[model samples]
Target: MNAEAARTPLFDEHVALGAQMTEFAGYLMPMQYIGIKQEHLAVREGCGIFDLCHMAQLRVFGTSAFDFLQYLMTNDLSRLSVPGMAQYTLICDDDAGIIDDVIVYRTGEIEYLLVANAINRRVVFDWANMIRDRWSTHQPCGESAPRQGIDLEIVDETDRTGLIALQGPLAIPLVEQMMPEGADIPTRFKILATTIGPTPVLLSRTGYTGEDGVEIFTHASNTAAIWRYLLSFPEISPCGLGSRDTLRLEMGYHLYGSDMDRGVDPISARLGWICPADKPDFVGSDAIRRIREQEDHRVLVFFTADDAIPRPGMSLSANGVEIGHVASGTYSPSLCVGIASGYVPTGYSRPGQKLDLQVRRKQVSVVVVDPPFVQGTSL
Candidate 1:
């Protein structure tokens, strides 16, 4: 690990568990604990815990916060009927290119928290602050202004906070035990602010593994103790990045840099669902609206190979014409087959379409398949 790369407070604990460490998004994190396949199954069948403190957390407050977020994100923030609800959204650039896919949580009437990928955290912060700065320097609109006394406060709370994801069919019950007596688990897409023992925390029923889970956020100093307490449950297995990737990939979830990037528009990635056309204007709304109305020549798709494993950069062809290249691929532990996702000509992206995946020098037969390779028990 590079000397300057930041380590989560659980780094020492990972070493104690004899985890195989790897560098990802500038963090020295565990890639696997016992093994990827075992951990993946544990999460599906029982429960698994992951250290997710590397993800970035930002807080936006003040009277202008809601307006600022509504203008900044693709999903409609007004859909959150009550505080403590969470929305999966995208923050895109001016051209409707996805800068990052993020989750926005309404923590209060005027306060929200945005969670961004670790590698794209700074980019998100810079983009959001730029808008806040512009709004702060301007005067309010005439009598029709949305609100009065508007001010914006943006804070990056990544380093000061620790996060852990407990996911699986049993996650809710396990997490409930850790919460203070009489406290209840939050409903799906909802958040709860409460305490575990003496540690203050925010628990959200959101996860990347396509499973029922709660992501707990607490003070960085309290992470180690919380981690130990959770692991005391004999059924809770410790998972790492390797299993996390396979699990999410199995669910057809997009990884920030791999599946979508600053260069890829939401329409091409088939992420238009997050960009509701009826929502109030937001960044890239014009471009996204245009893109949505037009047909994209290429679209992302999921395919499976029976005999060959697909890897990123591998080529895809149909009828001897190069169509696209693999974006993300791995041997799916759950399906017991090689599955991949990539951009293919729209004609070849439909389920049951036959395409050839170039694995090294050999052409392997692959068939387009509908995603959620495995149905996740999220609710």
Candidate 2:
């Protein structure tokens, strides 16, 4: 690991467990503990815990926070009219290109917690401040400026905070053991403020894997203690980023850099569902609308390889002619097959469509399929 890479609070705990550490988003993180396959299956059949302290956390609040975010994000903030609700939204540029895909949690009447990908921490934070400044000074031609009072503030809280995820079939049951009596576990896409044993945390029922789980946000200092306490459960496995990638790939979840990026629009990435057509004008609404109406655009699709494991940047060919490239790919532990996602022209993006993946010197046949490659899990 690079000495310049930062370490999370649970870094020592991962080292104690004999994990293989690697550099990710300028952080030295665990790539695997026992093994990727074993850890992947553990989350599918039982429970697994992941250290997500590297993810970026931003706090936005004040009198005009609601209106500020309404213009900044692509999703309708009205869905989270009350506290304790969470919505997955995309932060895009004026060209409709995705800056980052984030989850916004309404923690109070005028407060929000935005969680973004670690690699995009700087970009997303800078973008937020730029928009906030623009809204505060630039007044529209005829309409009243939403930032008249300039009461909004955006703060990066990633270093001072810690994030952990407990996921699987037994995730909820295991988490309930630490909660106070009569305290209800939050449902999917909901957040609750409570204490786990002695540590106060903001628990949200959301996860990257297609499993029933909760993400706990607590003070950075309490991360190690909480991680160790959860490990006391005999069935809980300490998972690493290797298994995390595979689990999400099986669920067809979009990864920030690989699946989508600054050059890709949500509509082309199959994430248009998050952008409501009835919402008020936002930064990228016009460009996204144009992309939606255009007929000549590439579409993201999921596919399965016969025997070879595809990887990012591998070529996708039809009739021996190169077309697109794989965005994300890995072997699925639950399904025991190679699964991948890539972008291809809309004409050849349908399920059952055949494409050849160039794996090194060999060409492997692949079939496009709908997502959730390995179903029947505890979602």
Candidate 3:
């Protein structure tokens, strides 16, 4: 790809560590540090440091930050008051189509931080920019009155920060051992600001791997040194994107590009709660408004199989009748079974129902099951 290829901050470390590299979301990232299966187990049994520098970060600050975000996002920002507390939200259009999913965190009294998916980074930025502009224009003006302008700012910290996701049951203990000042790491979803050795890192008690873990964000320059230190802990292992995908999939978490997109509504994605009606307006409120007023027939179903891995786009049939196609499918390491999540006929989405998954040109036995194929106490 020549110079057109973009390298992440850990590109050198990944190569030196003999990681299998791949292009993801326009960035060259390590697909696996050792191997997908081995690394997948590493995070499941122990803990691992993942380079999440490729994700985008935006800062929404000033008095109007809160209200401005509430209008643009689906989740109620009203409940987010405590600093460093983070919650998941969906950005959607009126048609109920999800624009993106983001994590909103209150960094200060009136400031918020939004961490978005890699693929929708640019769209999120532009969306936030448009809201901020509207807020400025609509703000009321009066002397000796509270400032009306919602001072909102979206700062892209993607290039400046490095992220490490330490996931597993042993994550808390492993991170506590890496602290330089002998302070305890945050065990819950709260964010803790501290130094690992001499380098500063913000550890958030959150992860996408459906395990009890911490995802740390730090300066780009200090990533390598901090990564090396984390690896020194006996409980910490190194995980890559391949394992990360499998882990999230096992928990039935939707991957933005695969399980969802502009074409699929949030209801069909089984993420309907992400839409908050209290908000005055958002991108996809109108569509969702109509759907919620009446019973919608869209639903996301979990199909578990024993013989074959359910590949995305595979035909789903009921009594030999084609109904839908698989959106995402993978072998579950934790469950020791093949699992997939996809949109299906609303009538067939019921639990305990049976279906056929055409995997590799062959119909495989499959049964509908509840989400979170693996039980994790983290959530």
Q: List the residue pairs that clash in candidate 1.
A: none
Off by over 4 Å in 1: 135-148, 376-379
Order the candidate numbers by lDDT, best to worst: 2, 1, 3
lDDT score, candidate 1, position 55: 97
| lDDT, candidate 1, 149-239, per-residue tens | 6688999999999999999999988777777888878888899899866778999999999999999999999999989988989989999
How well does candidate 2 match the true structure in TM-score terms?
0.98
Clashing pairs in 3: 92-284, 93-283, 93-284, 94-283, 94-284, 94-285, 94-287
Candidate 2 local lDDT, 1-379, one digit each (tens): 5799999999999999999999999999999999999999999999999999999999999988888888899999899979999999999999999999999999999899999999999999999999887767545453556445677879999999999999999999988998998898999999999999889999999999899999999999999999999999999999999999999999999999999999999999999999897775787989999899999899999999978998999999999889899999999888888999999999889999999999999898999999989888898
Candidate that would win on TM-score: 2
Backbone clashes in model 2, listed as residue pairs = none
Among all windows of 10 consecutive residues in model 1, the one with the lowest summed lDDT is: 138-147
lDDT for position 208 in model 3: 88
User: Which ten residues in a row are the worst by lDDT in model 2?
Assistant: 138-147
